[model samples]
Target chain A: MDKEKYAKLEQKISPKPPLLKNVIKAFLVGGTICLIAQFIALFYMTFFNFTERTASNPTVATMIFISMLLTGFGVYKKIGQVGGAGGAVPITGFGNAVVSAAIEHKSEGFVLGVGSNIFKLAGSVIVFGVFSAFLVALVKTILVKMGVVSW
Target chain B: MFSIYITSFIVGGLICVIGQLLFDVAKLTPAHTLCILVVTGSVLDGLGLYEPLIDFAGTGATIPITSFGNALTHGALAEAEKHGLIGVLTGMFEVTSSGISAAILFGFIASFIFKPKGSV
Candidate 1:
């Protein structure tokens, strides 16, 4: 078949995604994840000496830990399948990515497989996160010294 | 308190919806999207723009990966104020150490206990 005909045929066969439904699912799932994190933060604030800002650190850590556990049990994959970006926009998504990679490559042995491959998905996040922060700080420092803008 | 929950829910939900649109319409890879968000977050935080959003939305802003980048920048800047040049070296990771360490540690343990479904 000609290229145009082949493209039309492929389009006919492929299933269209339910875009609106998927968006609602993602919205609900993502909102729920944030709600859980907020609850944890509030718990820390009320029960401990942590203020709202300080409570966030532990809240994030706890979310990551819980997501990692869920990823191990393979529940997170299901959540990802259903939630799409909803499953990925949170820090829990980062946890799921890292743990899933490590789990997927576990049989190649610990050091090379789990250790090296674990960061495959999330390494870029860490690298760019740190790099961008450094660049911004460098600029801020220079601008402050130059008296162009003062914090 | 209730307003905080509603604001957080709506903001967080909107961010996720935007991310989904990027994935579906723009065809950006998740990794690329993640990198973009983190960088954008850091830049906004540096420019003093993100703090206001965080103030308005609370965990809605803080729960996203962007906020993690914002937190890193905030920590680095605070450290730089106290320690000067040396802070640039130590600040980013120092502030994020807890989250990173937890991710790595939990990931390792999970890997140890669970086996892959099949060899690729």
Candidate 2:
């Protein structure tokens, strides 16, 4: 029965590609995200004495925040609609993921319902990311100490 | 500079191509695929394999799910280092709150005005 179900499912094709409107919306929304990052980079460079090279980190940080805000307000869904993954795939889009998930689950309550679970998807991603990077950084630090690598 | 640009363009395009193939050819939802990509990117980055790819490809590597993971990790670490235990939560938000707020605010406004239609 499972094999037959799998076979039947595999044979189906979506009637069309994701809608053109969605693609364009994604393009515009995604492009807007990039533009915001550029602005943040420029701002850091101009006001904080950060070099062009150093400003990228802050820019990425800013983009994530903006996407989070957008997700909360619900504009990203529109963008996601028009943009599909185009709108939903960027760093800001990741923000949308966390916030939207929280919003979806918000009816549960505040502490566990909204506050703790608000950033569920994003939180997991961050946890894994930080832990993994720590391991990498540790290896690099050890290697550098041993003169096997240089920063 | 020209060579760098060319390399980034090609690599970014390739990354998108693979992502697209995963979307169109494979049987995964976009979010699921993105989650997988982000995790994969983070692991590769953790192994230090992704850094070189990032140096070479710039936007290609930076534009995907992995980049998101990298940012989260970087933010959390920075926060934790500065404030100890409390910094973990504060760090994540402090690092990302602005952009996240911006995204949510604008997304909310847009949704309110435009009423985007789709299944979540």
Best by lDDT: 1
- DockQ each: 0.65, 0.20
Per-residue CA lDDT of model 2 for B1-120, tens digit only, reads 334445544554444444454565575676566766666665564455766775665544565556655554445445545554454444444433444455445433333333223446
- Please list the C-alpha lDDT of all candidates, in the order they appear: 0.84, 0.55
Write model 2 residue lDDT over A1-151, tens digit each, in one string.
6998877776685364554444344445444455445556657978997875566556656665666566655667777666555555667666676657656655565456556655566555555655555544455445655778654
Clashes found in each candidate (C-alpha, N, C closer than 3 A): 0, 31
Residues B1-120 of candidate 1 have per-residue lDDT tens digits of 678788888888887887777777677888887888888889998999988987777788888888878878877887777787567657877666767888898899989788655321
Listed for each candidate, the true contacts retained, as a fraction, are 0.69, 0.14
Model 1 TM-score, all chains together: 0.91
